[model samples]
Target chain A: MYLKVELNWNVVIPAENLDIKGLMLQKAILVRLLDDFAAKKATKDLGYLVAVTTLNKIGEGKVREHSGDVLFPVSFTCLSFKVFRGEVIEGVVHKILKHGVFMRCGPIENLYLSNQKMSDYQYQFADNPCFLSLKTGSRIEKDVTVRCIVIGVKYMEAQKEFQAVVGLEGDYLGPI
Target chain B: MQNKSGHFDAILLCFRCRHFYNLTRVFFLACDAVPFVLSLCLRKIYSRLRARLKLSFNMSAAGEEEENAADLKIGDEFLKAKCLMNCEVSVILEHKYEQLQQMSEDPMNQVSQVFEKSLQYVKRFSRYKNPDAVRQVRELLSSYQLAEFELCVLGNLCPETVEEAIAMVPSIKSRGRVHDDEAIEKLLNDMSLIKKFE
Candidate 1:
């Protein structure tokens, strides 16, 4: 069983004379963790911890200040779990290029499925878009498994484009 | 005597006014001196900061260049390997005239032409002013030829071996042969010869 959790929080800043009189005062926003819903846990289970900095103030009020949605530039060590060269993992086709197609599983960016990897599909690059075949908007909600093949990884030191090979092989592909 | 006392009092008043004026001048001078001192300190700080920032920028730029050079070196190694392999394959083909006879005349001629052109280019390009660069190029050529020989043998037996051959080739450098679209296309096609792994 997998546990999905969403945490909501509101922070209050005490009003001061400087704040009331329209003098700009720096406000330090703090992120707090409420609770975790655990489906499965071992001996030692650690809860999620987050550190945040306020980018911009969206709105202010007497009782509470309404800050705009928090934006985080998240970085991950592993984009996807390592599978065998031919094994398929379910993914949503995110983008299509002349060279390849990019797919997304969860939070990972640009898992490539090259033109050569598209098997058994009559992909017309010119007229109707191949990406439209996946029906991105609707397919995103559905769980689709894709084969994660280990193609050549091009490591460009200058641009830092780390491309990995992932594809939908044969007739076992498409939206569910 | 009474007029003399009145004259002394007038002189005393004049003296006090002059002292007051001098004090005011000194106060103004001090006020002006404060900013001058502050400005000197600020200028010194700014110069130091500017120097540090410039140094950092220079270091970062140098680092980036070094990284690019390293990447280029890797690509050069791959290219040298491919060239060497192609040379060896050509030699092998020369040894197997019977098999060559079996191939179509047009393809055989085309392959021979391409092989000869590659060899000539490699030979010409290897002759650099720098002996070290020449030596490096030669070493790369030999290794590349050996890898190509291995790939040719493998490719003849199995289709998967073609990928190894393809991987040996490096990314096309846009330098030299500007306005030569044919050459660029050939280079790109060569690089793409590697099949996407399954």
Candidate 2:
């Protein structure tokens, strides 16, 4: 199971007494997080945690100097078996491409349903003349079941690439 | 007796001439006094009118000053609130990033595309990192005419690795537990901290 966390940026120092150089150093920490965590291999323990950071307010330009360090808190959440493959997930049909259907499961997130993965009934129904004539915005009112499989994961160091595989199968194989 | 009648008529005329002249002089003096008295009254009225005009002018000037003071006060209060909010957001982002950095084994190589895109926020914070950096970012943000300071911070906070950036964003822990809007709003609000980057 993955833990879910919510995060945002908060300035530890007041805007009237902020140090610009200090803020830069502090921001560097965020850069490190961007590089280290978001792109890494998914571990069983890590599950599927989503981290988020927000920026709320800023002081005026005239007095921003002498203001303390500007802080940013990146919040995150962990989705256990719910969002993983094989979990019964519900989503809206966002788009239909020549290859497959795309479902928007959550904000800023999307999933792809390849044509090959569609069940025979879905394939046949979609292939029908009436279905083929449907437009892009047409709502799909069908449930799909599929196992989550680690199709491909990539890690880049400088200009190098590394790959990792996670197998998602079993009851995690349906579309809602 | 015939000579006495002529002398008596001459004597009567001579005795009244001087007295009549004195009476005429008194009459002219009274006419002159009337005009002098009217002039004095007019002077007093003019002075009072002039004083009233001066008072009104002074009052208007004072009113303008009071309005200016009120406006300045409002602006100051608003800026203060804004500064506090920005500070909070920056702190939160820093804390979350630190936690993720510690947890990850290979902090450098992770390159999630989504995370990579999000790390652009680091640049936003870069504006507040230093005086010089803040100045530079302020100019940039101003040129773009952006209202939110957080956007500027995000512009400066680009991460070196994409995966690390992705890790910074909180993942969905469970279905129905987190609302995407709430998360995004929080992120946006936190990013506003860039307003204090100066």
Candidate 3:
């Protein structure tokens, strides 16, 4: 799901980007903010920072005594994609393994749907491998969109990424 | 001598009758005791099982083990924040990229991989393309008084029927007690109407 969250952060303007005119200073800060926003792609708290919608406030700059850099406190609202447990999300199947399949849902790339959860489907070994449903005769192969319920979510703080285990055990949760 | 022998046989028969009656009374007592003992054991086991089941039920209700749409674990900050559907996101990203291109000659370097991938994903999955249709869809779903998350899910997925919608988002049926099947059907109808017009 995509959420528009309000956040406050302090952005620093190096000596090189600093300018005398107010308009140029504002432009420099805005550019720095966007660059920083792009660099910090994802956080544990806010799944993935997609885009900055609006810049609300830029506070008075405080000069650093040692480095001659100006620190500005900024508040903005940005779009983030965070998947909660039990969220029914659709993902494209990217890789098919013997035990399970890996899918990419939004910014989350490591969504694992194990064969144990897909009781109705059997792993068929063909020229193109796929999980063939016995009841419906539908196949889940490469690039097929599958709707699954998030069973568990793990956040890697170091990597600023989320990994989830999804399941097709629920009603109407399967290949779409 | 014959009279004395007949008296002895009568005494022996009387003693044998008393012994047989005593054996039958003991057999009946054991049969009665068996069910009483079994019932006591069953009652103990049942009470223990009921307590355990109650504990598990309470845990599940508290959103420990199982998570439903109603009991989302997303932080309170996110719950209050406005949610954007896939279609809306596509519009925003496209506009941002356009703005970037207008501002600078090299727009590709300005945007990150996350931006490009997101733009692509939303473009592929976005159900509604027209901006007016997107706004109308949001307004229509909002009228139903769904949670922000639920509203976006329904918008993004665009389930054709109430049954499919309910299946995709179970909380709509279980959490929103005011919304019955007919109301949901009407909601779905309105959504489809907008899509049809779009």
Candidate 4:
């Protein structure tokens, strides 16, 4: 899911980056803010901070005593993507393993739907490995779009990434 | 005596919150117990516990599919945030990327991996390409006063029938049963109509 989240953070500018003109200083602050926003990536609260849609405010910059760097309190609204359990999501199968298939859903790349989760489908050891459904004879291979419900989600604090365990057990949830 | 009175005020506050929240969806009584037995030290613990309980409340309401992975929750902070459908996100990201390309000499460096992947995902999944169709879809669904999450799910998936819609988002069906099958059917039909015309 994509969310428009308002956030307040302090953006720091080195002494060299500061300009004489007010407009130039403002431009520098925005550039620094965008750079920081991209670098911050995902958070435990908000999944992935994709892009800054709008800059709502740039509060008065305060100079630090020790470093002489200026700190500006920036308030902006950005787009974020987070997936909740039980939410039916569509993903493109990228890699097929005997145990399961790996799919990418928006910013979430590590969505795994295990073979056990897909009870109706049996794995076939073809030249290109795929899961073949017994009932419909539908094949789940690389690049195929599959709809699955998120069964579990884990956020790795070290990597700042989200990995989910998905399932095709529910109704209307299978290869699309 | 002061602490006792404060405890009563907190309970009254919780009841008022429950009353207001009940109007929207099922109200969980889990957090109501926070203020039942309050002491100076216990009150501090209760405040922290209330925050934790509220987080769980939001998660359960979001539709947990299983028992063990109860930790797979998107908290209330995100629930209240404005949710954009895949088509809408595609438009926004595409527009922002284009603007960045025009403004900066090194636009590729400015864009993050998340931004690139999200753009590709949305572009691939977005059902409606036409901007007007997107707007129409939102307008049609908003008439029902569906939660932002539900609205976006319906818009993104564009489920053909009421049954499919419910299957995709069980919360819509379970949340006080505000939407009947007929209403859901009409919503789906209207969504398809927008897509058809587009």
Candidate 5:
């Protein structure tokens, strides 16, 4: 589910938090830098940051002489999407495999719907495998929009994000 | 549009039994929460019930073991997409949009020039870019007690026929129709999927 989460972050600015052309630190530039740092960042608890929706609080800046960079403490409200177990998401079929298709579900790119999850669907190989259902003779192909429910989630340590295994075995969650 | 092997129906049947599976899960969670409250025998019974339910589900999965295994089972945070078309005019070089336009020419886009545009822009929902359609469908289906993925299905597929629609969607009692025909029809029309249905 998508949610608004308040996150605390430490952002760094090169060249003493101010451009050499400008005399001193600026709030607008700082906020802009902070937004760039925060957007699309994966936090420990809060899924992925979509965008900086609001800037509620800011902290004093500390400058380092050796690095000539300034570090600032900031707290902001950002839009985040956290895919939970049993959560539903919409996406398009990106890659067609021998077994199933991989849906590029927003930040969760590998949300998979295996052929096993497809009931009564048969896989045919004629240079390409199509998920064919004898009941409807329908073939779920690549780029088809599908509704899917997240059945299982396993956090990938390499990327430090959760990978969700989505199932199409539910109501109103098939090809749209 | 094809019903070659009743695969869709099999999936629907599995969905129909989802509530039973959920109930079993709840029972298991309850046992775990209050281990002292529930006896060892009851826990064993709960596990047995869950196992039985899973077995029943396996049969419904179209006899495809690998498909079920993958379904029963993405670390890219950033997307590197160059918008070939800006807000203004776009130039399609490696273009392939005729097939999508053939599906449905959505009224939401530039109606006059929709045929010339990319399907990506015409689609309301996307996992990478837009969440507007997904959010709207979620809000619409919130009243119905459906699984999270079900909303995705409804928004994505937007099935036309009653037979196809009913498989993904739960029963609607307040539609005042005998068999949810009108509701499903209205939903597809409302979602601007008349071309797809036709």
Candidate 6:
């Protein structure tokens, strides 16, 4: 599910980080202060704070001389996502390929609804490269919210990420 | 008449706390000195007292079968916390939900998959009918200052008996049986709905 995650960040200011913050270092500090804060504060309750959409609250900035970094004690709300097996979720169709369609569901948005996951709908490449049901002529394409249940999820060996393989074979889980 | 002693005792508690570590060290040293024979004798005494207390070691053979010790890794602390005790389906679900949210792998990752499957089964059990009781138990456990793991177990297993609690919770032993028992018994008494059910 989509969520707004609020968390605190105390980013270390390396000289390179300041370089990322062009001219007005003070204004750029808040944006850069949140760097890797999500990764640091990832816990069971808070999950992974993947995106910092807004800086809801800000506190007094403290500059450390030794490290040459500014610490911004701020309370910000962002987004968090998680998934469960056999859990059905609705997401917008982000990409359509000849193989399968991807839905940016929950937090990760790497959920791939493969053809094996969709027993009901057959991929019709002649037209929109969408999942077309031979039974009802119903087709699913980009920008459409499709509901699917997670069947298999694998972590990519090379990347620090997860891939969710969802199934639509379950009852009432095609396009909704 | 009460006005004579009415002045709040502004006694410094630091002086008393000064010996806390020394006293704890002494106690541990004393325990370490106890011989195997003495430990066996103590166990005898404990079993006798437990018999008098009518504590239930009634956890079924099924529970033992469910606990496969070799599978759990060190960081899989949650599984160890849950294996020995009974917990509410919803509470366990919530705890696992929180854990799953932070995990890099899928919930079915092999490292703790047995426990995960067990949790999925446990979630189907109907134990969360009373939200009010659940909330009270949650607050009460935090008030008791049980460790995160202990609180998780306590929130799930609303153990009725002193022995059941002692068996299920390691903190009870750590806090000294008498002190923790009294507090936990009071907590269980207050949660009558959970106390009566199972």
Candidate 6 per-residue C-alpha lDDT over B28-51 given as tens digits, one digit per residue, 9 for 90 to 100:
888887776698899999989887
lDDT of 4 by residue, B1-198 (tens): 999999999999999888788844543453444345345568788888998999899777544533321122356665677999999998898889899889889977778999999999999999999988888888888899677888888889989988888888777777375788989998888888889899
lDDT of 3 by residue, A95-162 (tens): 99899999988778899999999989999888879999989988899999998888877889888788
Against the true structure, what is each candidate's TM-score?
Answer: 0.25, 0.23, 0.81, 0.80, 0.48, 0.37
> Which consecutive 10 residues in model 1 chain A have the weakest lDDT in total?
A34-43
Q: Which stretches of candidate 5 lie over 4 Å from their true place?
A: A19-24, A27-40, A63-69, B1-123, B126-198
1 versus 5: better DockQ goes to? 5
Best by DockQ: 4
lDDT of 6 by residue, A77-135 (tens): 55443343444445568889867899865345577888766777777776557878988
Encode model 1's per-residue lDDT on A1-176: one tens digit a residue. Answer: 00112223333343431243333432222211111111111111111111111233324433433543332222211001111122223445656566666765322345677666654444446543453344443221112334343333334345423345665543334444
The DockQ ranking, best first, is: 4, 3, 5, 6, 2, 1
Model 3 DockQ (Cα-based)? 0.40
Interface RMSD after interface superposition, each candidate: 25.9, 20.0, 1.8, 3.6, 13.2, 15.2
| Cα deviation of A61, candidate 6, in Å | 8.1
lDDT of 5 by residue, B72-163 (tens): 21111211111111111111211223433565685334221212222332233422122344344445544444333343345544556666
Better of 3 and 5 by TM-score: 3
The fraction of correct interface contacts reproduced by each prediction comes to 0.00, 0.02, 0.65, 0.71, 0.05, 0.00
lDDT of each candidate versus the true structure:
0.37, 0.37, 0.86, 0.86, 0.54, 0.54
Evaluation by DockQ, superior candidate among 1 and 3: 3
RMSD of each: 25.2, 26.7, 15.3, 17.4, 25.1, 25.9
lDDT of 5 at B107: 35
TM-score (chain A only) for the predictions, listed in order = 0.36, 0.36, 0.97, 0.98, 0.80, 0.61
